[model samples]
Target: MPPDPADDREAGTVFLPKFDDRGLLTAIAVDAKNSEILMVAFMNEDALAATRASGAAHFWSRSRQSLWKKGETSGNILRVREILVDCDQDALILRCDPAGPACHTGARSCFYRRLEGEALVRVKT
Candidate 1:
């Protein structure tokens, strides 16, 4: 039998992830040591399972319509140290040690720009 939601959802030990309508959940990768936000992505069941099994970060590419392991081509893998699920189990934080740049543009973080007055300014690294 399944665990009761009232008892096992927020305060229980059981892990029950609440996926969205697209069978995906929001996942944020952060530097485990410095707490720097690296990137944000989505993960499906297969991506989550792969991440758990491989100790590497994997994500479902919405545009590509496929599951991809980070650093498959760039060798900038996000080595996951810990996975933290939100209280609602709808979002996840992947505490990771990144091998290289997290952004596709070779920025240390995907959020390498800041919104200014009608412009996107590059953040000083």
Candidate 2:
């Protein structure tokens, strides 16, 4: 059964995520201490549950069609401190303390560049 529209969900204590037609929700990871965005990924039901259970950031790999824990291979795990859901329950923000660079390219954040005019420019760290 679904949650009550008026008494639950956005205004209530129950956590009812609204996954998209693809059965995935957007998850954004941010630095817990500095509030810098680390990465953005997708999460399925299993990934969400794993993250909550392990206190680590887990995501659904859209390309690989599998579940993966952040930093599983690179030792750059994201230790999640808190998960904040959007009012509509379709998106989540994970505040985390990252063990190392969040990007596969070894950048501190996946978002290391900005659009300048028609080109991408690396943001000065």
Candidate 3:
């Protein structure tokens, strides 16, 4: 069943909720001027807890099945400016202040590749 809007909004405002497997978080990394989705990260229970406790961005690595802080090892830190949970409490919207490139390859974002016709070409690389 879908959760009540008020209830979920309250929950997100008061109690930071966890995301399920099917959940998808839209990480909108605006130029800090114009809002845009630079990259996205999925959060499990641990990731949510860690991010809530700390201002840092944490995500559950789907492949590794482990918790990973955005800039745990790298100096490129991703700070959470604001967080929004969907009405159904299924997905998330994170507005962040990226200190450095969000992409592991040191690009401005993870979505540097554009859809060229039908091929998935590396536009930035």
Candidate 4:
């Protein structure tokens, strides 16, 4: 028999993340100070474990098929402040303090472009 979902939600104890069929969970990182969404990434079991153990943001790259620590190369590391699991436990919110630009393009956020009247407008930083 399957276990009750409430078992995973017991206060101050359990942390049962619900990974998808591909064994990855959608993780959204946001700025701890202003609540600006930084980026969206996927986390495998290993990546999730690493993040919890190290307090750093780690993700599984679908294209690279490997684990990656955020900002490992660009010095834009995300220091995780809190991790909130969705009600369904299928996704996670990572509140973090970013050291530098969150986007690879040197933008503050990956969501810097917005759709406006059939055009993609770049929001000024």
Best by TM-score: 1
Candidate 2: where are CA atoms >4 Å away?
A: 1-7
At residue 63, candidate 2 shows an lDDT of: 99
Pairs of residues clashing in candidate 2? none
**Residue by residue across 1-125, what tens digits does model 3's lDDT show?**
87776675555555535345455343444444445566777887777778878988888887887889998788777788777666655577677888888889888878778787998777643
Cα lDDT for residue 4, candidate 3 = 71
TM-score of 2: 0.94
lDDT of each: 0.96, 0.95, 0.70, 0.93
Candidate 3 lowest-lDDT run of ten: 24-33
Cα deviation of 93, candidate 4, in Å: 0.5
Clashing pairs in 3: none
Q: What are the candidates' C-alpha RMSDs?
A: 2.0, 2.2, 4.0, 2.2
- For model 3, the superposed segments whose C-alpha errors exceed 4 Å read 1-18, 21-32, 121-125
Estimate, for each residue in 1-125, the C-alpha lDDT of model 2 and write its tens digit.
Answer: 87568556678878999899999999999999999999999999999999999999999999999999999999999999999999989999999999999999999999999999999999965
lDDT of 1 by residue, 1-125 (tens): 88678667688888898899999999999999999999999999999999999999999999999999999999999999999999989899999999999999999999999999999999986
For model 3, what is the error of residue 90's alpha carbon versus the real structure, in angstroms, after optimal superposition?
1.0
* Candidate 4: stretches off by over 4 Å: 1-3, 6-13
Q: lDDT for model 2, on a 0 to 1 scale?
A: 0.95
